[model samples]
Target: MLKEKVYAADGDVHPDQQRIYGRGTELMDAEELVSLHVHDGKCILDLYLRKSKEISVLVIGMHGTRHKVAVDIFSTIKQLKKHLYWENNFCLEGKVLMFNGIHLDDSATFSNYNIDDKSVLYALEIPENHMNIKIRISTRDITSVFLSKSETIKNLKLMIRQHTFIPVDQQELTLHDTVLEDNKTLFEYFQDQEDGQILTLSLIHHIRISLTVCINMFKSSDYVVQSVSLLGSDTIEMLTQIVYQRVFILPKQQQLKKNGQILEHSKTLSKSNLTNGDIIFVDILPLCKITINLGEGHKPITVEILPNDTISEVKDHIQKESGILMNNRCLLHEGAVLEDHKSVDDYDIKDGSILFLSQRPPELVTLTFQRTSGEVSELKFNPRDPVSVQSTIQNIIKGENESASKSHVYECKQF
Candidate 1:
């Protein structure tokens, strides 16, 4: 039978007590210790044990050079010291050995022999199973409304460029890295493209408008002047009123220039020459149909009208017939405000043209009450309370009781 042997660090070989291996052969050499790499579970255990001890010294420095070291014992300190010596050539000198940011020892020497410059050291004692893994998360940017003019596109581009996007050809001037040659509309650039590119362009335009509006307001003191200062229907009405005022107040002027000479004091014209006497005489066509969607309470109605009648007149007639007041209502053409003075002459209201007449939602009156012990403790009604039927009933009962008492008194007097 073969006798087992155990090898010690001192180069002395001893027979194993259990007699597990043959005795004639020496126990596995120190090189064999390299084969016994620490497993994940064993490394974890070692980490816990090492952390349990008082960490008096902590060395934080870049990894110098890493070379494998042969050690009989399995420990982080032994491995690290081996690597440290490997870095500085067997001498532990000129290295910072820190404890809580304070240097403990400048030249702490290791007892282990055969340490080399190529050995790697980690005084922090990271687990051998430690691994670095990377993960990625993706997001999307989208917008619904384009609300700014072309002049503000540069600022808008700066605001949205961080989100990873492409700009339309019309917006090329807006981007610092893009170039433009001739004039091109945004729609032209997006034309003949796949749905994805189209959608991206749409999103970019929408984002541009949003960013421009926001930046302009942030930089300017008159944000309210640019944007209507109300929510929902109020905003629409305010915008319409402003448009009406501008159209009515601003004087129309035409520039008359000849032979590179400017003419001053030109007469004001009500209508542009583009539509003046060049008009083709056409019969006043009837409104194919007028479709009205009032948001709530009534089904959409389609009506016909004569082309000679103005949109405001049509709205007034509709208001009278439908019992809908025009004072609080707005006329919308294709979801935009229909100017009160805009002629319906050139533009015919076709059968399918959607005309939306929106009214401001009615103000809500809240009646709040507090209940205690199955009875209302306090009641508050808005817009003042109405005359109650219960109060009238109580008054009638009191009057009847008074009449009965009087009749009884009369009877008593007669007796």
Candidate 2:
């Protein structure tokens, strides 16, 4: 096999390793190892063992200088260091050397390199892999973290923990919906994206998400107002209970409603479309106060009533307080008689408005009395009159006659 080789400092060939070929002998140009392809199972040991004797590798240093060094695979790394040199003919002593992204050590050999096979990168790509990543803890907080793209996700988390003072186990790094795995390298996760672009990484903690919720009972009643803190995972029904527990006094079996509909207990707040800093309005029945003028001309009686109450209910309440029967009472507002079957809201009896209440006039019957002398007497009669009708008619007939001798008689007749 024709092995490729280059000089340590210059392109001079090693004396003992050279060969002179005669007729029909093949001579090939030397191949320089400039780049390396990293894979899941490939390692620096595999690359070194694939070549034998002498190998020339082109290394690009941090200062942008090309370095050609000859490595003798047959000798140890400590022994080959004497012949290695860089651009200014600088000796390789105390200089940090890296092959395939691994920092070289005198004690480490090709067979004993300590590194993850997936993290092994080309020598010149070391600088490009050092990325200045930004970690966003919140909208107001952003922390910068310097890490290598060849580093594993677990390693990155460790470095971030040092800068953020957060526990590594509690941290979760995510790009979009994709959660980064600890075994994967940063380069693999963001390989398709461009460099220098701000990569947005979501930093989620293990604790529950906190948010503020505004409870508005004005939809039900204007008196209740409350603010509460809730977890994002909490359900809408849970929030309803917490809010109503403080605002409105509910019965033992009563439950709060939302927008006139019962909230689903199993749906989370986020799932129910209730986001942070959201307002939850409590559904309540509207109430109004009505004042009734009882014709006694004294102070009018005011009573609390619902808009949905029937007109009969209002009259009943008025009757109970004023000793007037509901049927005997008629209520009128603004010259309009209120029907018993209609609701209070239908009559537009707004809050603080006055309604007139008066006893119905009794039906009157006319009485006519005729005397034997052909004289006639007429008198008006009330069905609920306290005196007897006969007495009332006799009295009226007596008044029509000036004297007892000329008394007139009246008889009642149907008209």
lDDT of each residue in 1-415, candidate 1, tens digit only: 1111223332332321221212233222111211233234352111001111111222345454333444322234434455557763543343323222221211222211112233333333222222111111112222111212221434334333322233332122322224322344333433343321212222212111100111111333433222222211122223234433543311111122223332232321111111111211111123456677766787776666555557787787677667778875777775566666765553556666777787633333433322222322222222332444345333333444343442221111110
Evaluated at residue 355, the lDDT of candidate 1 is 78
Worst 10 residues of 1 by lDDT: 206-215
lDDT of each: 0.34, 0.55
What does candidate 1 score in Cα RMSD to the true structure? Answer: 29.6
Cα TM-score of candidate 2: 0.26
Show where candidate 1 strays beyond 4 Å.
1-284, 345-348, 360-415
Top candidate on TM-score is: 2
The runs of at least 3 residues in candidate 2 whose Cα sits more than 4 Å from the true structure, single-residue gaps closed, are 1-216, 220-246, 249-282, 319-327, 361-415
What's the C-alpha lDDT at position 243 in model 2?
A: 57
Q: Estimate each model's TM-score.
A: 0.19, 0.26
